[model samples]
Target: MKIFKKSDIILIFAVLFVAGIIFAISSLEKGPPVAHIIVGGEEYKAVNLVDIPEKQVFILETHPETIIVCEKGCAYFSSAGCPDKICVKTGRLTKKGDTAVCLPAGVVLTIEGGEYDAVTY
Candidate 1:
């Protein structure tokens, strides 16, 4: 005697298909998120990336000062006074979990994602 029937197989496949779709969609990010700037290993500034698509420029009053620019939903250090402009060259961080580090300036810019905080600890 067969233990499984044709309907059972179809239902199983359908459930698995829907579950896969739900998982994929849920795993995607909610939307563009804010990025946190860390200075000297301490949280310094929080900027919402979505608002920066206009490519506006600003300054972060770090010890050496960091010039920041936002463009296309990404943020980066355009200029700095550190001996090595590594942070300025690191380029813009756009996606969640993307990070740019400026060791000389003691700055870390990390993308914010999901419910958990990227800066609190």
Candidate 2:
């Protein structure tokens, strides 16, 4: 008896073809890179990271204050009043889809646009 069947091979090829199409469309939709800040599950602010004349810092006065710093083509959580400070440890976010979150303060910073890339845990 054969372990592989013709129908199974055709199904796999069809699935791969659809996945490739979806990936191509998604990649073509990206635009200039920008950083969006969300606080308390709401959009708080957005910063264009494509062109920065100088380093800029933003302070969010939440339950526990948080700080964001942006330089040319990169942004990061520089400080957080949270006890763990995990957000600050996330380091600079220079590529599309990068993110940093401070759970205690309900603050999230994410980079969007430029180009599409594979996601990682």
Best by TM-score: 2
Write the residue-wise lDDT of candidate 2 on 37-113 in tens digits: 99999998888876678988999998799999988788999998999999999999976768899999999999878
* TM-score of every candidate: 0.58, 0.70
Query: What is the clash tally of candidate 2?
Result: 0
| True lDDT of residue 108, candidate 1 | 86
Across 30-96, the per-residue lDDT of candidate 1 in tens digits comes to 6556778888878877878654546667677776888877665677888898887878788877777
Stretches off by above 4 angstroms in model 2 are: 1-28, 116-121
> Model 1 Cα displacement at 22 (Å)?
22
Q: What is the lDDT of residue 57 in candidate 2?
A: 93
How far residue 50's Cα lies from its native spot in candidate 2, in Å, is: 1.0
Error of 1 at 62 (Å): 2.6
Lowest summed-lDDT stretch of 10 residues in model 1? 112-121
